[model samples]
Target: MSKRLYVGNLNFSTTHETLQTVFGEFGTVITCTMPTDRETGLPRGFAFVDYATSKEAEAAICSLDGKIIDGRPLRVIEHQERAGRDHFGPGGGGGGGRGGRDRF
Candidate 1:
């Protein structure tokens, strides 16, 4: 099955195409994405790379993790799906402050 990897500690200058080129050495890179700031539109210093197979992803993790690129060590690992929870805070609960329904 296809696998995704979280690539962290990327240089701000790193581009999606650069990630593809780097990771492509291991296997087919299905997709590469580097999120940018909503307002500044600058790289978020990380990326996500999708490989055609888990083996390829594993190979990438083993070979690329801790490797320096653009003067920053890369942190490559299998992407773990985050657990479903509240968007606000812990215990999936929120909005219990002075401005809430208890306000006089």
Candidate 2:
């Protein structure tokens, strides 16, 4: 079965098509995607690549991880499921607070 990997520290200029092309050297790329910001629509400096098989994914990671691309080293690893964090602070993560005060 195909396996997916998380590719971090990617150049902002990196594209899904480019990723597929680059990683294709290792094996068949099922899919490639670069996460982007919703507001600015900018790359999040990371991406995910799905390979045709786990062995291919491993080979890609071994060959591409820490490899230079766009002048930066790539970080490749098995993709992990995301778990929502408790972004809420003491009151909340919104940073709502009183006026500035010099409290000792």
Candidate 3:
């Protein structure tokens, strides 16, 4: 079965292709998604990588976790579905100001 992994602590300059190239060393990367900021349209410093197989995902976690790239250590782990209410609230959007109220 395919496995999904959460890749954290990514550098801002890291790109989707770069992630594919790096993770591709272990096995086929099914999909790589890097979320971007809604306002700035910039990388959110993390990505989700889906591998073709569990073995490949394990290999990537073992070999790439804690590996330094662009002066930042990579945090690789199995993706887990969030439970309960999202900490970001209803729309999963940012909570600004006090008590989840918008300051603007």
Top of the candidates by lDDT = 3
Q: Once model 2 is optimally superposed onto the true structure by TM-score, how far is the C-alpha of residue 48 displaced, in angstroms?
A: 0.4
Q: After superposition, how far is residue 57 of candidate 1 from its true place, in Å?
A: 0.6
Question: How do all models score by TM-score?
Answer: 0.83, 0.78, 0.80
lDDT of 2: 0.89
RMSD of 1: 4.2
- Indicate whether candidate 1 or candidate 2 has the larger TM-score: 1
Error of 3 at 51 (Å): 0.4
The best-first sequence of candidates by lDDT reads 3, 1, 2
TM-score, structure 1 vs. true: 0.83
Tens-place lDDT per residue, model 2, 1-104, is 98999999988887777788889999989888888899999999999899999999999999999999988899999999876666663444575676778754
Better by TM-score, candidate 3 or 1: 1
Q: How many clashing pairs per prediction, in order?
A: 0, 0, 0
* Candidate with the greatest TM-score versus the true structure: 1
lDDT (tens digit, per residue) of candidate 3 on 5-101 = 9999999998898899999999999999999999999999999999999999999999999999888999999999887786766776765657554
Residue-wise lDDT of candidate 1 within 2-104, one digit each (tens)? 9999999999988787898999999999999999999999999999999999999999999999999989999999999998776776775555556767667
Evaluate all candidate structures by whole-model CA lDDT and list the values in order. Answer: 0.92, 0.89, 0.94
Candidate 1 backbone overlaps, count? 0
Residue pairs clashing, model 1: none
> What residue pairs clash in candidate 3, if any at all?
none
